[model samples]
Target: MPILPRVALLLAACLAPATLAAAPDRAPQDVSGRVLRATGTTTSGEGIPGIAVSNGIDIVRTDAQGRYRLAAGAGQTVFVVKPPGYRFAEAADGLPAFWRTVPADRTAGAMAIDFTLVAEDRPAVSAPEVLLFTDSQVKSARDIDYYRRDIVEPIIGRHPAALGVTLGDLVDDQVQLYAALNAVTVRLGVPWFHVPGNHDVDPGSTGDAASLATWGATYGPDTYAVEEGDAAFVFLDDVVVRPGGTGYVGGLREDQFRFLGNYLAQLPRERLLVLGMHIPVFDTGGRETFRGADRARLFALLKDRPKVLLLSGHSHVQQHYWHAAKDGWQGAAPLHEYNVGAACGAFWSGAPDAQGIPDATMADGTPNGYAVLSLRSGGGYALAYHPARLAAGTQAFTPAMALHAPRVLRRGAYPAWGVFANVFMGDAGTRVEYRVDGGDWLPMRRVERADPRLLVENVADDVATALRGFDRSPEAVPPTHLWRGALPTDLAVGEHRVEVRAFDRWQGEAVAATTYSLQEAGP
Candidate 1:
């Protein structure tokens, strides 16, 4: 199958564990030559026809001889979208080198850009699973090791996803640490893509475009895309730098809009369009995180057909939003946006575990982790989130939600308390129900409150006389994915097992369990 089209942008965050190991060499640069051959594979390497190449704005296919001519403005990049059944060699540092920079000085008669690819042993995939990670934001070398051990290590011989993407804030203002982090991620084998975050912007940069110099040099084009059998994935650099490079806003630059307008027009409506970025398209902190007009413009450009899914990071907590007309989304159905959990949960805060890694749960109660995106043939999709560390080895993590409840309650007393089910992947329409001791299933009410489980840590931190951990657990914030159902007061006088279940649109039904007890009312 031929790899299809669309474009994308940047990668993940950071955390810390007990050990601090340095990462490998920096990623490889362009296809060897500064002076690239554009026409004669006989010399240009552009001789292969039907290959897709782009300048982040215009996309063109190679001529009969695999030769292509693309117009890339000064400072733009020329990269080839990895077609199915093919692979690029990893640079010295293990990062796949697939792009070349178009020099700032373009007045010369002709410019050279190199793109090289080799065949892979794997067969073409009709459908692919992609891992989506974000906000590693590690500040020190210790955080790098934490990210490596806590996240990457378990995933190394484990994940078989086609490729991976990091939504942004790969590090916390520590730009120099990018190489070390890349060394950690390269172990996954699949090519990883990244975009800049507010923390990723070069502080020394004079403006928005300049802020990404370090990022672009490390990860290629701030905005680009790739095609697969089931969808077209696009990455966009949406963080706009403020004047004097002091602050930033979440939005897309004009050049991206031009690129999107041109690229989307050519996209087949039958294919899914997955846009990956660091900052979310919605407002944050009571302010417009993204420019309203730009969002409106971007939305208007995306026609109703073909399923469109947006993946983002920046808010450490996990969430989902369906943009409607009021939000300037006038599509056939409300637009679905999944605000993914941070890889460096709560900036790697919380009490250290036995392994010396922080609890790192997001303030909204989601444990720091990453997402698995399953893109099926014919434009259908499904997704699941994996908390960094799971119970024991080999057994893949299950249980769509985690259950929490009282240990023992007075028998025959007012059932004031209830069980809380934090349905990790739940949404507004997701049906979550609970039952006790083989009784009837009762629907759990969706609650926008802190998860009672995490509250214990928050309260402990507030009342403690000394530091609880290297960093305190995140202060609990009301979460949109939590559910509650009061435990019956009249239940039998012994321990009772409670069961909870939820329906995931794609993965089918998922179940979980916990226990609570009832004691005699007497003191």
Candidate 2:
């Protein structure tokens, strides 16, 4: 076990309230405020006991009558911590129906919010395919049209995935568009869950309590859980509102950590614990994007659960991270975090195509698209990336890398013209290799730099005389998935095939091929 930081140990001790003590029966608190009687029942109206409910602060359990009362202030959201074997009803656009926001009109007094859960008879899904989309950020009808044409159209009624999940940033600062997003997602014909991103916050809220008011009204609780087959998926609201609604920060509240501890305590260790959120728990750019103490508390809870996967999406970049003991992970195996790419690649910016959709390749050269995760019977998971558009004259599934090199090169000038491969999901440890004319494979060095192709793509709009469709793709940022190597300078004046292959830590390999010709020195 790793040594606990002094602050984490102190926070843990302070967070151990009497409410968490084991008791056969406890009476409701005698606090003065808006009292909410939260009751849980089956679809047939039978009371279901021992369900936990929260108002984002205090956690209370139902009595033998399947009811629990908690205090709720104005703009507070009261949500149920959904139990196993029961499924909450979903909203029209696939948001879980597990929470309710107290109206501001009711300044004082008591109200009753009852939750009805239907018994779910899920099949023994030994291997289930799950759809994952991130950073859709739909803001207008045109954006919706783009999504419908490119994403929804190709995915509906075709995929065999059991369910789908969006890793936050559902809309671009317009909570109202969630309905439109939901309408589009509903056609997928599967249960969908969401996480609250920074952009999803209500700007009018002065504090964190009301930041998710609109989100809760539309997508149920910001924090909840769902169990499918042998996997338990937990969604946490990691975006805390900045004071005065100026911005947001990546941190977990004490109550959220409390909820994780209380909920996970009831679950068996054998279940695969899949944690999903908007901001990543891992560090980014030497910054403490996530609170270290909060992360330590969570790691302490899941230290024994060997099968775990962390998912997040707020940076609009796809990359993988492994957390070992130094990062506070105590498991025998390192934990994996998959920071998925955006569906609205580069915020729907770039050159337009024949269909009027933007190229929108990400800074890392990952095309605007989604991912598919396959879960096996023995708590194993594999992920595959899918691109939105295929290259010219090709119909097969898109490859991960898009090689950036000129189609023709002058002899002896190959040293200046290096081949750069943009491996969409690669990290520093990923193995990248390239070969010329199907010869010996040579290693390509990983480079933490902006994607050269994106730089060139952005230059197209910068140098154009008139504005084009949509907007120009933003300037390229330093990418974590790029590799480069100089080509051989002695090739003959003929066509040469360059083949590149990349292998991720999960044992997934992707390959791409292109041909270029070497020309004579003089004309």
lDDT of each: 0.77, 0.74
lDDT of 1 by residue, 1-523 (tens): 3232322210000111100011112112211122122321233343333555677876565444444555556677887766555555556777766777876765534455656655544666666789899999999999999999998998896877877888999999999999999989998887787877889988676678688888888887888877655777888999989878577888898889887776676667887888998889988788888999989888988746549999999999888888888788888898889999999999999987889999898888788889999888888888899999754532112446667799898888788899988878888888999999999999999999999878988998999999878889988998889999999879778899888888887778988777889989655
**lDDT score of model 1?**
0.77
lDDT tens per residue, model 2, 252-323: 888788778766765667767889899999978787888888888888888888899999998877888899
User: If scored against the real structure, what TM-score would every candidate get?
Assistant: 0.89, 0.83
**Error at 38, model 2, angstroms:** 21
